[model samples]
Target: MRNNVQPSNLSPDPRADLMVALSTDQREHWQHAYGAHPHMYGDQPSAPALHAVEVFRAAGARDVLELGAGQGRDSLYFAQRGFTVQATDFSDVGLEQLRDRAAAEGLNTLRTMVVDVRDPLPQADASVDAVFAHMLLCMALSTNEIHALVSEIRRVLRPGGTFIYTVRHTGDPHYGVGIAHRDDIFEHDGFAAHFFYRYLVVELAEGWHLRDIRAFEEGELPRRLWRVTQSLTG
Candidate 1:
């Protein structure tokens, strides 16, 4: 297990006023969640992230762009392994915590930024060697937004670059349990989540080469997830 450190008091949580949908308000919700606790999630690198490191190393990738990098666990892991990492999230508090952790660890290769995946990424075309997002795609985004995000990811990646991400699958026990917001979206605990089906994966892989798909579970909730890996065509 990784050691947990106390986060700085960047801001207080305002979860009481936050909404559970895909809007600017959702950003505050995440910020509140991260601020309310010393650590919202574990410090250990997620399984898909660990797998991505091996894949990227084998592909001779030295730079990685991580979307929705909540607490920078995977970013720190990659930085320790000598990969330059750009870690982004919408939560200001989360990014601040990540910056603190990176500085303390002397991980100069890891940089944090406030970014919303629903918007165009702040990156140059073909600038990154790999793109990673663990459970970012399953957030409260519409189908169109997911497509746009994926397109942005593909645009920023170098030719033959890898894109690795994980998302909650429809098979998850939590699917359709909470208040239904849309077709596959559900709201619970002041957050909205859009679950994905296998067919939706196919739809998302329109331009990229779908390399692999694997199912796994994690956390006390045993959240079912689909780990997807795709490659940009040369």
Candidate 2:
């Protein structure tokens, strides 16, 4: 973790009052959760991250950018595999823990950044070789926000850059059970998730070469997800 990383604040959005409110609450919830339960997700990388290592390596990727890197488990794993990783999340508490672990492990290839995916990415255009986001696209983001975020991902990735991300899909058990927000968003136990339908995935991959969309499950809730892989033309 680098010392110069600055935290980003969620700016109010006049267009979507509900989105801004939910995002703010979600950020605070994640911070408090990480503060109360350090290493909550444990040190092991998620199955998607494990799979991403092979995908990234086969694509000859070196530099990686990770979004929603809670506590950096996957970020650290990527670094361990010799990929230089920039791990980012909205929660500073989670990122601080990530930085401490990276420093303790002496992993110079890994760094942390505080970023809210709703905003334009801080990276320059075509700056990274690969991008990974494990269950990030499903967060409380609205449909338009998700599209905008994918646009930013495309902007930051180089030609031929592999982009892999996982999202809890509409098949999830908790999908419609929680407090409902617009655009398929639902809040359960303080975490808001915008469950994706297959059509949304296809729409997001319109111009890119969509390699795969594999259905999988995670957690005790068995959160149903689709791990999507796509790439740009070299």
The per-model lDDT (C-alpha) reads: 0.84, 0.91
The alpha-carbon deviation from the true structure for residue 204 of candidate 2, after best TM-score superposition, in angstroms, is: 0.5
- What are the TM-scores, per candidate, against the unseen true structure? 0.89, 0.93
lDDT agreement of model 1 with the native? 0.84
Q: For model 2, how does the per-residue alpha-carbon lDDT over 1-234 read when each residue is reduced to its tens digit? A: 212133222254455987888899999999999999997999888999999999999999999999999999999999999999999999999999999999999999998999999999999999999999998999999878888899999999999999999999878999888799877789998889988878788888979999999999999988999999999999
* Candidate 1 deviant stretches above 4 angstroms: 1-21
Give residue 35's error in model 1 in angstroms: 0.5
Q: Which whole-number lDDT from 0 to 100 does residue 207 have in model 1?
A: 86
Per-residue CA lDDT of model 1 for 6-118, tens digit only, reads: 22222432431232334565677888889987477778888888899999998889999999999888898999889999999988798898899999998899888888877
**lDDT of model number 2:** 0.91
- Deviation in Å, model 2, residue 219 alpha carbon: 0.9
Highest lDDT, which number?
Answer: 2
TM-score of 2: 0.93
